[model samples]
Target: GDANRAEAALARAEGRIPDALFLIDQARIAFLEHDVSGTEDYWAACRIADEVGSTEIWLDIEVLATPEEHDTWDRLRTLPAADRDACAFFRRFWNRRAAAAGMGVDDRIVAHYQRTRFALDHYRRRGRVRPRFAARLGRPTNSVYDDRGLLYVRMGDPDEVAIHGGSDCIEPNISWAYDRPGGYRIYHLSPLAGVDDWYLQENLAIVYRCGSWDRNPMVAISPLLLDVPGQPFHDLYLSRMGLDPRYARIANHALSLIGDAFAGSRLAEELTVEREWTWQDGEYAISTVPERPAVDLSVDFALEWLQFRAPRPGLTRVWLNGLAEASALQPVEKEGQDVYRVQIVWTLLDETGLFYRFIPSSFDAAVDGPLDDEAGLSLRKSADLPPGTYRWMLAISDANSTADGQGKKVRGGYAGGDVVVRDLGTDLPVLSDVAVSADSVGAWSPTAGISLNPTPARLTGDDGVAFIYYEVYNLTPGGMYETRVVLQPEDGGPSFDLSYPGTAQRSASIVTRGHLRIDLSASSPGRYEMSVTVRDLTSGHVTLPVRTDILVTRD
Candidate 1:
């Protein structure tokens, strides 16, 4: 026997760091030879394995040192080589177990495993014989010699253990109690046939089976008691035992726990939260249903486009809630139906000759029948006002009346942001806001670009040309002016220049309009600065140059 064990030890020491495996081999041989130093040998092997960063070897030693069923040993040997690496395999196994228990592995799994291994070493050093399988001569028993050890591996250490009933005709048994969050679980176990093997017992018709153990033991139950179902070891164990419905419920709860845990992760926020109110503080294209009567008349109406996918086919009403200075506007009434509206009023914040229009606008679109899943709503409204900062709140509501007319109408969601309307001063030769138009669709108004569709200040070579529109106001009556357009790279590069001569007629109020198109198909992809300069040749004064940045992209 010594020669055989020495040969096994020699084999283990070959082609490997000798200390950990050699010590494990010594422990195994000593245990087989019934040497009293076996526990010390195993402990030394564990320490060395840990020191060498060979925790897998330490786990293997623990497994070999524990008693297990013969079939468990057979199954373990048949495991794929990938699964035989104890560290990696058990890490994944415990993570799965923790997830099934509705706990995150990041929180408590490593501590649990460490405590289990510590308990095993503590009990073994005390020479306390743990419950193991009934050892049969010449048959391999892979079962842990200690039933409590096996339970500890599966469920972690219990809160308390109580021994009862070794007196009179009552057979002695031990109860392991766990005070867990969901509830308390108490296991009743007793030795089988006065041996090291402990089996679960049913009392009062309640079967407390040792689900983690093999070789079920029988116990007499009181007939007067109603039969109670056995408790499973764990959720995953229940699933493995073919309890599909119970496992499904447990899995759903576990999924909910996972969702709650990582709900605030960056990836989750990116997927669910939208950055819709990040519009820059600038005048956006305001399209009105009816065009303004004159250039001097304040704009009384504005429309903002709102588009979103509906979760289901139904009437969706989108409206705006005005706050702060915008509260002056009354709710809009259309066909006797109260609708949300934003009123824009022009007010001069300073005596610097700048007038601002605070325009409040809102509307809703109603869909009545089944529509494309990717459905959208277009809304428009009018508001009269001077320029000022207005806080606008856009809300969407379910208009269930479009259906059979029964569901309760409720506000679904809302987005709020501030909009600034800068005043175009009339005292100087000022240019109106530059409008970049991509297509020629309507009668081009010098005050507004064709179609009034804001280009998002971007151009692509595929469009060939970009239409530019703006009006110069307060020019000297009967004045001759030289207008120049310069396009240069935003990085102060050489510029392309165009100059034209124009004359303003003598009138009470003078305004000069200009419309031009720039060929962009030849431009490279980058941000370009477009500057419009007007020189009043009669006064030899150049109006403040109006500059706008446009981004160009390759087709």
Candidate 2:
């Protein structure tokens, strides 16, 4: 509700003052509320105004936000955007906020979630959960915009734009008064062609002229999306050819994929009457064909050993696809059954990272009821889940959960529409280094993932620290893995390491590139280590072993 009120206030400000600060203020309000784009734009404005000072820029003022305020934006622009921008912003902000508050903000991300929740009671669609959750940004639904829902984001607040505001000398004498921070002003001098003109008070350009708000949204698939599979394909689609691609990695990737596939080269041919789809948009099947030509084949199987148990007493549901007979969950073995299945191993994972081969929660067993059931899918069986439309995926067999050695590998899979178990969690300790060229980020853009070739950068600064984190996956059961990384310069210059105890952890750990930050002041440095040991903990077992060498250094 606060965001809605703030938005409404901002919209009305466009009428009250034809300045940019009001819009910028509104954007700040959204940022304070964790509006992803709003936070990004505000910081961008704030940073740009400070570093590249110009009369036309209306963003964060160095006089108010200080040089430190612009520092975040400066550092953030180097990131690849998306959550990266958001993450960097908070890291910078919290550092400042902590200094201001005299205490550190919790580093655990999910912990800060509550403070960001939206007030659904206000400025929400008639019957929706949370605003963004129920409403797609660009898609037409019961949203506020139709078709393109055109929007323009500028630097600062619109109300603060200066212009003639007096009734003197027969001319319109209007000028913005409150040009300082903490206050936003706007002027609604006039509306033209049903579109009102508003500009920021400071640097102007903080004008926002939103089209007629749509109560019943016009539904179109969004051009913004994610890299994960089973997601609504956007940005990369044929329709979003002319859309803004900011923060649209998934869509951007798809667009790139399409380009690589030369989809445009065959656009005219694919749209012909004879070359249509078996499933139209939104599964609105418009075809007369009895069976779809593409039948995805798969299998399901259980691991040879497992002690499956749920955390609490709940319905043990069994589902799979492919073959004729169902799993052994319910005995009475039927004839002609294929035994290939993908079992979900949960014990093997946790948020910190993952070890290989954790036990599963369910195993194959014989049931007394029903025929050798056909492969199937499942959803929450009431009482256990909330009431909402949740999508799910089904597996006919274990093969559905996996691909053959020759076939492409899929990182994750869905048991039902909602329960997605990605085959990937943590990568076995691969080395990566974080190297910041300068203490003050001014002209320095930090680089990571260092190598031994070419020219290695010299790391500088007091308390200069390099973070080396490795990801691990598919570890041997009960078998421990250990690897020691050595840091050194190519020409026997200098190196560093984590001081003793803090440097080591069972199986995996993070260590300094070298013990002395001064050692890395050389022109070029190389981090060299020989032999990484990865052991599977299982006793007397021929466990599959995987080793990953992590290269961690401060560039």
Candidate 3:
């Protein structure tokens, strides 16, 4: 209802000033209501209304957002109004995120708003923002959030939070622990500038230091006084305690107080560590956590991809066909059946800021017969893309696995390499990548009858014959052509080659498609490279042979 009214008001306020003012008001209202998408939309609209219209309105938006989000808004504001590329990026970023979360974009937007709202309500500073503590709290001095709010914006609420009031000798501090996905992260926060203004303290010693002794000017203070020598402070502290009974008491107290499931010994150990450090002014240094780098798991898998000219000009149809071993997947029981679920993502990017990502396949395949050591599930997908030089990545992950610290599902198999798609000139005969099938073929692109099921692992079981499909372009009328297929073992072994002469059945302007049945029955089971080439016998024109590797399994 409010959105409708805002739209009506915006339509009425056609001028730059009125529209900007109205949109700014709507943005603030949305921000207060914890509507991140709405606020961003209104903010972007206002900026597009007039880039130089009002600096005050930009300030208003920044004031309402977390320091991190303020940077995001600032970047968007500086871009040209209604920039197509920027708008596309914004939509793609949110849409891809929504797909990964297995929800609609709207739901993802709502969830993000909820997280920010929680931070604003809970982590915002209760008192005035002190200028001296601004850098310690986060960026943008006008932000109302403390250190906790800044952290919350970057990483959603920690799995466990504990507010520990200072004992007589210790300083008041807050402890946070994340133990689930991306290993363990334990953070400590101290009120560096009074009660309401908190700063992230890298020094664990500050939490339990004797305030009186540290303040004494006579004591020779080393800058190292604040630095704890151990990483993952939880382990080293407990190790230093050396079988102290106090560990159990602290753990039990923490479990009871914070209701953290993993708090038994871990939290207890951390708490004990907190109480052991001496007070010192540690150099305020913030740790830089890299944003969501892909976690690649060492898993056995195989991939084969082929590309052909798409129906539209300047676009190529890409087909990815491969299989993953059963060991690479985690079997989860669903509806009385143990099934392996996996999510496959393909991403393409270039230095020119071109980015395209798609979830090609996601499915739960039920276990059949033995959980094979060779191959568990077959993976295949087709997509049409424009010509470009891109670094492409294909990621396959166990869908049942828990999300890592950065919220990406732990990937089981990952592969990346550079790829170049170019326009196939009509003047020369160019052959597409050979599409091979161990079994039967199916319909695909280029032509209605061109579908071929690419063999998994490039394997030809029981039957020794491999079916191959390919298209040849720029043919002459009634052209006499020779199609040659070769099977050569990577190992120094005997090779097999076949050449068949045929007349072009299609017009010179159309692509000439053909298939071959290569007998590999007598060949030994091993890895072989299959290459295909077509030659115009009458015109003495030949194509550059395209080759793909295949793994032939024992019958």
Candidate 4:
């Protein structure tokens, strides 16, 4: 039967009527028929219709959604024509949902469709018949008019259900409750138009209605599980639910559970929480606050660094607040010398706050005497952080210490900072901030290549050469590009240009290096400006040049 309906829809699509509704019908029919590649075909048709400014087609797609979802879709579609691509919008929407669910988009969508079909079959087996009006109009029997069907399609099956009102003249209604791993939801439904078509009620208020209203009656669900951990989504859910005060406590409980679970994971090896009694001596505590100075969205990472003074060798604990995974303290050697360094890598989707604490080991207490001077510890860590402004607190503490002569204990130190992560547009070519390194060590990182050890911007003529490092993104793969670095003296002297021919790779980013040499015997010492430019030879597209100031000192 589905195949026959698909064939009819296909025939209508082939009529060259150029109607958006007909094309969408064809796509939906293909989906119903279990055509594997039909979704892409539907996307192609929608793209063409969008290019032709088919507003009616976009509206038709919105009508297929529940009232709340329809409102969201309509608002997105109302964006400028250039910003509205049906396929891209839908893909992004599904991708975001998948990310929130910690699942893949394709798998999630398939599950949704399968659940929809299962709901239809379930109602059919229960002897629920479609209304005459819906049947005559050729509407799907399990359309949104079927409240259970709609909920099942969006969120799978409910964990529990209850039927109410079987006495007197009162019509019977059903209540569905879901206790999903990600969240909870409750839906109240009643039959409409004296038919088997059930629709969600507007609210708890009892009212007799013949048709559906614009307001969606279903109680909005909030994520309640530890596994689904995105603060942005949680905040959004809270806002949508009118910010109930009780949710704050519930969220805190959930986070604690998540932390407990993470502490048992393999990643938590050698990690132990300090007991309250063991933390009695606070005088010898050390603290460091994490700072996010720069964020690059093009690479989906943020630059986080912190500096601290450790009075004694101790165990360090570092983790992102409200996250399930934490880093285990490992041995770090700098310049063949053992030191305390903490590195944390995070993604844009991760929670913002970072917690770090230090506890002195017994060995340190035996070997190293009371710390008289601060042993400075500085570290640089980078991770992906989505574009947003966040206020975060970095707390550091000394876990090993004794009370002073007066039995007075000191408290741990904390610092707060505002971090703003920016997004670089993908449509245009851009360059990262340039850093000059005298000698780089360690392995290459996504944010900073070659473990750059930055030196002062001043270059003496006797230094021979200075190495510059920068990254370019969104370059056309396989295209020939020219990179030019020029140095101009501040006193209106002639400029020196260093040019290099490069081949753009298939990757979205390219790291570049430039070397500049100054001869004191032949040049005047003054402030100099260094500029870097990249131009694509294939398309003749050029990026806006970036410049840095350098001081050329007399050797």
Candidate 5:
């Protein structure tokens, strides 16, 4: 009702008020009414207003509302108090997150705001606690939410919700379930005696009685004995049975959207509660949060990237590609020709904000692949990045793929770790990271540099050879050097270690390039860590080892 009243007032003074305060209030009112697009409009207006006093007030409230463990909140504290204006930093923070997730800033803000509204609408507690069976609840419970509300804010919505009423055997409680890529995740909340609020519980079970206190309501019984069919209690028991370890293959999964800072603390507390209490499985099983990939693609594919020294000083060049099986792509036939078209978007970010973004590349009608290979398509490109460790993401969309004209779903993913663009201008002996490929290192020459048809997937069937290419810089001229290569099985199986002895014959140059043919006939079918090490024997200097993962499959 208050939001409606505010909207009416704003509508009446629409063009009459151009002040920052008016714009800020309009933005707030729009957000309260779930007008995401309208809110963004007023938000832009407030940013350009000469006087930011009103904007500062709004930002200050948001900063206080955010959890201290949040990445942006923690960083805001480190800034000078004068620069801690939430409005000034909010755009930059969301911009980086959006860039890193391969999405538009407006889209990201809309999603976040919608989630916040959803939490408040569904999880926010309403009235004060009316003491159920005691004179007054012990602890003060004036918070806007209980445990469930706080979790809803941190995590999005649960896939399923179940509420069980108070019974002679068990207390009133609610449970949330998530069907994660790894396995199912469940959380239980129940009110304890003498406590004024709800808390996370470790186990969900129905109680029964036995022996001397069989008739007593306080007597607790073994939960295993209550397994029966066609009963409400039995149905709840069946839900608990789904938490078995065998059903969940493994617990290791990706971090939640909020990262591990706040999630970690909450998980630690849950674990402590588990250890202190008893469960049917001896210990409360706390698995990793559901794998929420920063970027999600509709089709299955692998992302491949390699960093190289740029022609311009202080800049590094990064090569990126997303490879998928040709069968996975739905290319349309146009003008009597097959058209395999895709739109590619690239974004790079550091701790601050958006650094650089490639002009989104799109193909109207392109060839599937080269004449030789038609099994897969390669969407390969390159970008020049300044020397720094940054997070990068690439999103690709099939130009023609759509459902009833509701725009094609973007198909791509982001790197799990930071993309470090090293300063390769130093005079010290240095070697580039090894690049693996299923094909040959096409044509190699001093002036032409080196060409490689790299296998972005880093996979090969058991034909028994992996072609590798790398460059060495600042080496001793006309000196002897030894290049060592090792393909160690990740599961501690046998390793393929070999050394290639060579000499640099050119006295005028210190840079050289080479390729290796490593035999994998003896290697088993599994993932292997391929390490390349180059040592200048004349100066007794060894470059650091560079490693990459390669998967081998038996034909």
Candidate 6:
């Protein structure tokens, strides 16, 4: 006000001020005329704008997702795009790879698109933890508050995740993590093994780029404590430091390493495809391509899914992979919205190919709860399953694909993946050198040189993971490890069975494969235990230390 007015007065004194100066004088006139304030000080302009609700000065903190989309969109979007060069290279790689595999670019892209959406949702900030409404959508979850809990579902075990940090191993990336959700203690999220720099920032994860791996936790949330119902890590830290001050120093380093490692391993991941489409948002049309997969189903296998798809104007014929089967998905209201979902269960009838066996009565998705206005398509396992590979095939078509009741001309596109069932329950007749061999019990002798495939993860901080190395000597010589495990009691729990098919095709064959599983209701939550006994038919040996406890939780 002073400077501009001073200049204006000088102009007026000179008797030649410009007409544009009239607005400033008018504003001053209005201020005096209205007697709102004595002086129109620029510094107080901001307050006035706020009081008047000026668009430029006001901010809206309302949550953005609609009530119907909450379940699907309530996750963070973590990955920054890879380098331009790398992404281009990936695109070219896909083009070549798909051509060789007898698929189109769109087909392969659509298949992975869902995964991209999952990653973004899981890691991205969903919304303000608490804006105007009293909601807690952004926090780590529990069963009822989260529908996608099963999306990251870790079944079969929750024997606390272990973390490990090695001395002098500065920034050793312990880049290992389970691809899916479950009761897991996230051991590492940084390039340095055993570190935890949780900075929930987009740039943090970009370090996982294959070409130039960033040495930091890909997506660090910093060192914030979770409002846990049980044990407290911060309290544990204080106690450990009191016992040995070096413990404090080591603990911090361990966490950092785990963080780095977690981020590092993410670099090797195959990117998932993702897309967001809303009929209400616009007049835009979304097109899709599809693919199918087949797997054998025998006693060794317990679950399988087939995908069906078509474009906007069509319905599709359902099938077991490519083998035709009778299936139907009723369009109904879900999550306060209408959706089309189905589950297909099949049996093996031929020695060489898959046979369309049975279509269970349910056309509902294997999902957790009711879809509020926000539900999307997701799969849920309804029963405890045996060891084997269960393939999910999806046939997606445009909403109008109801050639109906008869089932034909229904075509869109498809996508899918495989789930491996490991013996989580039952008796493990033999485990060559199970974790605590020192506590030897009534069990079998070790098979020398046997090897358990090493998972691409490592320990950091106090977190630890154990791998059991072994080999099936010879089934022809007669051998199988039968171990049974049960889920612990909780709001939601995990269950599994144990089966050891020999080291050959039997181990991999869905038909004659090794199978050990526990059947459980998806609605329950809790911890599960395994009371397993292993016996070796070939060596006439028995393995002991048969009991282990694992905790699982859900909504």
Would you estimate the TM-scores of all the predictions?
0.31, 0.18, 0.61, 0.34, 0.59, 0.20
Name model 1 segments beyond 4 Å from true.
Answer: 1-384, 393-416, 443-454, 457-461, 490-495, 553-555
Report the Cα RMSD per candidate. 28.5, 29.0, 9.4, 21.4, 10.1, 27.3
Report residue 239 deviation for candidate 3 (angstroms).
Answer: 9.1
Candidate 3 TM-score, C-alpha based: 0.61
> lDDT of each structure?
0.41, 0.27, 0.58, 0.42, 0.55, 0.28
The candidate scoring highest on lDDT is 3
TM-score of 6: 0.20
Off by over 4 Å in 6: 1-395, 398-473, 476-481, 490-534, 537-555
**lDDT (10s digit) by residue, model 6, range 1-555:** 243564466556443533323333333433333333322331133233322222211111002122222332222112232311222222333343233223444343333333323433453433323111112223222122111221122111112222323223222222211211121212222222212222111111121223122333322432221221011222233233432343354335333433234432322121100001111111110011111221111101112222112122122212221211113233556665555544333222111112112222223433333444422332222232333454433333324244333213232333344434333322333232122111122122222333222111111111222223222222223234343333344344444554543432244211112222233334233344544444554555555544443322332
Ten contiguous residues minimizing lDDT sum, candidate 4: 281-290
**Candidate 5 collision pairs:** none
Whichever of 1 and 3 has more lDDT, that candidate is 3
Ranking by lDDT: 3, 5, 4, 1, 6, 2
Per-residue lDDT tens digits for candidate 1, residues 269-292, read 321221110011000100100111
lDDT of 3 by residue, 1-555 (tens): 255676667666657555556666566456546566565555465445554434544453242234454566667767766552433444544444443333444444555555556667777877764434325434457556776766565445554555555654346777654432333355567774377767666444444443244432212321112222222223323322322344344434433433223223454345435433311111111222211213345455677767787777767877777677777667887767778887777666543532545445686778654376756576777777777776566667777776667434364766666777656644788888887777656533436755555654666656567777888887666888999978799896988998977788667766778876777787888889988889998788999989887667655
User: How well does candidate 2 score on lDDT at residue 114?
Assistant: 20
Candidate 2 residues 1-555, lDDT tens each?
366787777777775753345445655566556555554444444443421232223122221122334454556555553433333343444333222211223321111222222212221223222222112211223332211111101111122323322221112212221111222222212111122222111111111122122321111211111122122232222122222122143334433443223223232222221112211210111111011101122223211110111113331111221122343222333444433223332211112111112122322433344435543221111112122222222222232343344213322222222332222223342222222222332221112433211112223433333332222334442344443434544455554442221222333222212121223343232343312222333322221222222223443
